[model samples]
Target: DIEMSTSTRGGLLKGLGRKLAGESLFMTTYVCKSATGMITFTPEAPGRILAFDLEAGQSLICQKDAFMAAQEGVSLEMHFRKRLGAGLFGGEGFILQKITGPGLVFMEIAGDVREYDLAEGEVMRVDPGHIALYEPTVDYDIAAVKGLKNVLFAGEGLFLATLKGPGKVWLQSMPLNNLAAAIRRYIPSKG
Candidate 1:
């Protein structure tokens, strides 16, 4: 159990850096009153994500995956994409973002973020980065419609990332460009 308190001073609070097994604790840096904090997990790592709603003290499970991370007081669940004809039209994908409560989210990213708004009944097609974190209730699926072949091919790609109705989506301004840049800088070029 870790105890953290809010600091009146601004700028992100420093990380506590305490590790534990299956423990849920509050993150002071990203937490806020109106919105919840977010966190991301990487592959081949082991740690249990936990959250608690102050209103009820109800604990929530963040997610179970090597590529998963969590905030102190946020909850998460598995959301499945609906299948279409022969289950081939739509692919199987899962979004482990947020479930309930408003706080803060901690994300490990390569660059800054960019965000967009989707009005009620409005759908937004994004390239993963456009979505930092979102509510678990929203529906998602691969936007591989047959008619818009040109749009898919020319614009982005075959897989059009779609998010539906009434939730906040955070997007990173720069995409995976940073990863490639890092590799180029560190790894020696072989002539």
Candidate 2:
């Protein structure tokens, strides 16, 4: 039952009044400035992405695309990459699409979000899609490590995209893929 104060941007501010919890299965909302279009994450709310709009009146349940917004004078793009050895080798093992944001962005997940400050001359390895937002000044590149024996026997896959930063990074505790997997486990198995 976390609450966020409304913005002072001066418009008809109102809560659409929809109960979007466990019963509803997948919907959440946050306050955003219609003028600035900037929204922040909340703790009580899930850390996964949810649908939102600046112009729409009624609350809507939309797909992944609905959460994207263009702000901070930068364009948003979705980048997808595939992982070869996922669960079997403690990997995500699927194509993950991440939203590249260069502004004040908001994303909702299933648990509390965490922020890490990458020190100067230091770098960190993160799951490709877990990167919520980062400083535009950081450098990024996809690197592939070669080791045939490791891939075949040790199960250590050889490729990963490395992001080096001297900036802030946000990661969501709950990934969308994990959420989907949870739902699948509860559904009646067809086969």
Best by TM-score: 1
lDDT of 1 by residue, 14-96 (tens): 21111121112233433345455543345332222222232323222122121133345444333333444212432222323
By lDDT, who's the top model here? Answer: 2
Give the per-residue lDDT of model 2 (tens digit) for 1-191: 33344332222221111111111222333545454564444434345453323232211221132243333322223222233343122233222223333344444545445677777767776554454444434444445545777557653345544656676555556556666776788999777
| Whole-model alpha-carbon lDDT for candidate 1 | 0.40
Compared with the true structure, all predictions reach lDDT values of 0.40, 0.41
Each model's RMSD to truth, in Å? 11.3, 11.6
Model 1 deviation from the true structure expressed as Cα RMSD, one decimal place: 11.3
lDDT score for residue 61 of model 2: 20
